[model samples]
Target chain A: MAEATTRERILGAADRLFGSHGFRGTSLRALTREAGVNLAAVHYHFGSKHELLVATLSRHIDAINAARIAQLDALEAAHPNGDIPPLDLLNALVRPAFAFRHASPENAEVVQRLSALLHSEPLEIVHPLMEGLFSRVMQRFAAALERALPDLEPEEVYLRIQITIGAMVSALAGRHPPDLADAPGLDEEERIDHLVHFLAAGFSAKPLNGADS
Target chain B: MAEATTRERILGAADRLFGSHGFRGTSLRALTREAGVNLAAVHYHFGSKHELLVATLSRHIDAINAARIAQLDALEAAHPNGDIPPLDLLNALVRPAFAFRHASPENAEVVQRLSALLHSEPLEIVHPLMEGLFSRVMQRFAAALERALPDLEPEEVYLRIQITIGAMVSALAGRHPPDLADAPGLDEEERIDHLVHFLAAGFSAKPLNGADS
Candidate 1:
C-alpha cells in the first residue's frame, strides 16, 4: 500500500478521534496512537490537539462556506433586481454541504461526522475555528431574506437566520430519519436536489398574521 | 425547610448530569451525589441511572409531543384539505414545544439541553419513547408534502423532514451557534414565530439543480 502522507495521517487520526470522542474528550495520546505515528509527531506538525482539529476542520468548513457564497452570488447575478427568491439562498446554504454524494461520499461523511461531533461532546477549541466563517456567509443570506419577505424586522431576520442554520445543521446531522413508505430510487444528486427545492419553496412563502387568507 | 420529593430530586439531578456529561458519560454515583440522596432511594424511585434520565425527559417529551399531536390535529381540522403548506406544518411542529417556555425557563433549558445531548449521545431508552411518536407524525407531514409538491417522492419528504427537524432542534439546542451576535429582545413567542416562518419558507421552496443554477 502507498504510505499515507504525514498530514493525511494526522487528519485521518484526528477525524477518527474527533468524530468518536468529541473535541474535549479526545487526547493526544489517543490521537497519536490512532494516527499510528510517533508521540512527538503531532506536536511537531500541529503543536496542539486544538490546532490539529482546527486545521482538520478548516478545509471542510471553508469548502462548504465558499461553495455557499459562490452559489448565492451566482443566484443573485443570474436574477437581476434581486428577484431571486429567498428560498434560493436557503438552497445555496444546504446543497453545498450535502451535494457530496456524487463526487465523494468521504466528503459527505466528514461533514456529517463533524456535525455530530460539533454538537455532541465538542472540544473546548471548536468555536474559534468557526469564528466569522458562517456569519460572513450569513450576511449574504440575510440580505437576500430582507429583499424576499420585505416584512420582517431586522431583529426577526437575525433570529430566523440563527434558527434556519440550526435546522439545516440538525438535518445534516440526523441519521435515522423516518423511513419513507415505498420510496423511489434516489441517487445522491437527486436527494440533494429534493432538499434544496423543498426548502426553497418552504422558505419563500410569505409570512402571515397567524392565519391563512 | 420542606423536604424535596424523590422523583423531583432524581429528575433534577439527572437533568444536570445528563446535560453536562451526556447519556453514556453520566453515572448513578454522580446522580445520587447531586440529588443528595442515597443509592437506595434512587434505586427505589427510578431503578437505574438510565431510567432516571428517561424519567427526567419523559415529562418534557410528553408535553412537547402531546402538544405536537394537538397542533397537528388542529391544523388538520382547520385546513382539512391535507394540503397545509410545508411552513405551516413546520410551524405546527415547533410552536407547541415553545409552550414550555412559559411554564419555566428551566423547562426550556431541559428541552434544549436534551436536544444537544441527543446530538452527541444516544440514550437507547429514548428510542422506545420516540419511535412511534415521530414516525406517525412524519407520515402526516409526508401526506401534506405530497399534496403540496407531488413532484417529490415520499423519501424526499422524509429527508427534508429530517433536515427541518435538525435545523429546529439545533436552533433550540443553542449548543454551537452564533452566541456573540447581538441577540434581540426576541420574546419567547416571537422567536417561535420567526423559526416557524423561516423554516417553513426554506423547506417549502423548490429544489435547485446545482449551486451554479
Candidate 2:
C-alpha cells in the first residue's frame, strides 16, 4: 500500500469524529489532534469544518454511486432487450452501499451516522448535495422499475421507490433491521439479500385498488 | 387561555432550538434566553440540559403512545373477532404519530427533527429511552400482526415489522418521503393512508423462499 496523503488522513479523522461525536460535538481542536495536523493545515486544506464534512461525505458517495451505476449498466447489458427485475435494480442500488460496512466498518459507521444529519439538516444544506449525488441514479432506477412493473401506476411506483429508499437507508445506517432480540440474525450478505427480497416483493405487490379509497 | 407555566415555556423553547440546532448545537444559555427565563430558573426547573431533553421527548412519546394504544384498542373492540385487516392494524400504529404534524405544525416539526436524533444517537443513549417507550407497544402490534398473517415465520414477521417501523420513522421524521420535486403531493390524511397501504402490501406479500439464498 502507498502512503496516505495529508488530505486522506484529515478526512479519515473527521469521518470517525463526526460519526462518533456528531457534527456539533466534534470540534476543530479535537479533529486536528486526531488528524495529527494543526488548525492551519485544516484551514489550508478544507477551508472550514463544514467544507471538510461535505468533502468526507462526497468522497464516500462518489464511490457508492459509481458502483451502483456500474451494477446497473452491467445488469442492463446482460439483459439487453429485456426488462431487469425491480429487485435486481434495487439490489444494484443498495449492494454497493451495504458493502461499505464490510469494506471499512469504521468509516461505514461514520457514514451511517452522518446519514442522520443528511435527513435532519435544513433542506438547503442537504438538498443540493443529495440531488447532485442521487437524483439521477434514483430516476434511472425508477424508470427501470416502471418498465419492469408495467401495471403499477407511476404515482404508486414513486411511493414504493420512496419507501424502498427509506428501507435502504435504514439498512445502510444500521438503524432498524436485523436487531430484534429474539429474531435470528443474518450475516451481511444475507441481510442485503433479504432486504433486496423484501423490497422487491414490496415493489412488485399488486396495485392498491378502490378498496383502500 | 391560561398563561403557560415557566417549565412548559422552557420545554417549548428547548424543543424548537434543539430541533433546529440539534442537541449539541443548542446551548443552555441560548435555551434560557429563548425560553424567556433566567439561568437559575432553568437550573431549578430542569436540573440539567439532558433532563430537559428527556422531558421534552418523553412528553411527546407518552402522548403518541397513548394515542396508538387507544386506536389499537378501539380497532380491536370494533372488530371483536379478530377480523381486522393488516392495514387497519398498521393504520392504528402510524396514524396518531403522523397526526402530530397536522395537530401542531411547530411542535410536530420539533418532534420530527428530534426523531433524527433518536435514530442517529448512540444506541446507549437511545436504546433505553426507546425501549421504555415503544417495546410493549411494538410487542402488542407484533402479536396482532402474527394473528393477522399466520403463515409468516416469526423471524420474517419480525423482519417485516422492523422494516415497517423504519418506513414509519422516515415518514414521521418528515425526511425522504415528501420532498420529491416532481411527485404529486398528498395531504396529511392521504399520506397516512398511502403509507398504510404500502406497508400493508409489503407486509402481506408472501414470504421469500430459498431462491434468494
Give lDDT tens digits, candidate 2, residues B3-121: 58988888888878877776656889988898888887777998877778878887887788889899889888888887678888888888888776677766775666655666566
Can you write out model 1's per-residue Cα lDDT over A11-93, one digit (the tens) per residue? 88776666555555677887777778887888788887656866777767787788888998899889878877765677787
True contacts kept of each: 0.47, 0.27
How high is the TM-score of chain A in each model? 0.72, 0.86
Interface RMSD, candidate 2? Answer: 2.9
TM-score of each: 0.73, 0.89
| lDDT tens digits, residue span A1-213, model 2 | 135787877887898898777776788999988887777788899898878988888888788888988999998898887589777888897788888667887777666765566656665677677777677777777777788889877777777777887777776765463245566655567667667777776777787654443
What are the per-residue Cα lDDT tens digits for candidate 1 across B133-191?
46676677667777776755456566777767766666665535454356655665766
List each candidate's DockQ score: 0.37, 0.44
Kindly report which residue stretches of model 2 are placed more than 4 angstroms away from their true locations once superposed.
A1-4, A20-25, A175-181, A209-213, B19-25, B80-83, B175-181, B209-213
Model 2 whole-model lDDT (C-alpha atoms): 0.75
True contacts kept of 1: 0.47
Give the lDDT of residue A86 in candidate 2: 76
* Index of the highest-DockQ prediction: 2
- CAPRI-style docking class of model 2 based on DockQ: acceptable
